[model samples]
Target: MTTITTSAPAIGPLSTSTIAPANPRAPSRKSGIAAASLIRLSGLFAVAAGLVYAGIQPIHPADVLASVTTQSWAVIISLKLAMCLAFLVGIAGIYARQAGRAGWLGLAGFVVFGLSWFLQSGFVFTELFILPPLASIAPQFVDGFLGIVNGHPTELTTGPMAAAYSVVGLLYLVGGILMGVSTVRAGVLPRAPSVLLALAALVTPAAAMLPHALQRFAAVPVGVAFVWLGIALLLELGRSRA
Candidate 1:
């Protein structure tokens, strides 16, 4: 009697909220993964190109020159240049993960390695193309240049180019060793490939300096080392998907 029964609140229809449908056409996790895979593939191709040019250096200098003049060398050189660019991208990826001074150093080292390739290729063009054409017509030009320094104007075999090659080779050798070490230390790549790259770095200089008698044998190790590095990179590309 003292309290009127409170009217129960009327139950209303259950509120229905509309949820936005995910766009099926939009890129998904899988698409992102695929894009990353493509980038890695490009990097692998670049490394392979660099190795091919490195291998050709010891095998057939004359043929390498002919190939370059005829534009065949462009294929490999372009590949190598692509590799350098890819390597810089890779280094950027590394920096994204690590975010430190080491990333900058690694990038610098990669740039040096890339520049060394350009230097080696340019040296070949000048010595094999420009100088030879000039010398062909101007032995007097060669002699004047050589004799001014008390050197003889001999045919530009590996001898004349050897010094330049050694310089470029040394740059690559040092740059490679640095980058390989950084890659291994940063865990950006597999240890095996990094180790193989380091070994290849050492081998180039050894092949360059080894007594002529032992160069043939020394070169075998260098070639094997590069092939091994390439295989390791390929394996890395496969493994990164998971």
Candidate 2:
């Protein structure tokens, strides 16, 4: 009998084919979770910004020119800061979440909505830096400017200023409506809040047409929607972490 030294054939290193392939989606999933977390964080700013904006009622142009008190300035400045920051961080996350899912609508929403925010910041900048000083020196001029701000362009409003106001309003109104619709279609967020987002956007400009007392509160729907979306994102984030 052969020394029957049938030594066991040595096991070769496992072939690459036999090895389990790493999950391709794991990285993407992780990234999505991270993005969601970031979106949640930004939602805080959005919620605060919406609330502040909703609460604000631009002082009568006359009042602004007459006194420009410290408290009033502080409030206006705070609202501007919050509004700018909210859109900055909020839109980044909105784009991240919706871009992949909402297609062209998402793109449109992101562009117009983001532009609205940018335009708003520019307007705020003018208010903060230019108007205040001007108010002291040329109350009459500011009064004319305020007319534009109030969506009532007067003869005093230069063509450029009137154009700016129109652009801002159009962007905000149209962008908001498109974004809201896209958000609803994205289906990643809660449906109710998403609908509210759209409703708020649609109603906000219309709300402006309401009586003076109702005008300031026109922003409340949007604010509430932001708060809802923020809370939803945060909740989803917690689940993802778990």
> Whose lDDT is greatest here?
2
Candidate with maximal TM-score: 2
Q: Which residue pairs show collisions in model 1?
A: none
Off by over 4 Å in 1: 1-35, 54-58, 61-102, 127-132, 139-167, 203-208, 211-229, 239-242
Q: Residue-wise lDDT of candidate 2 within 95-170, one digit each (tens)?
A: 6766779889988988898888887887677776777778767777877776676555567776998898778878
Clashing residue pairs in candidate 2 are none
lDDT of 1 by residue, 1-242 (tens): 59867565545453233346678767786786776665555455445554554554454322222333345444444544554454444433433333344476576656666567667556434433454455556555544433321223345433555565557767878877776676677675566756666677777655645644344444344334444444554566577665
RMSD of 2: 5.2
Task: Give the lDDT of residue 221 in candidate 1.
Answer: 40
How big is the positional error of residue 159 in model 2, measured in Å on the Cα after superposition? 1.2
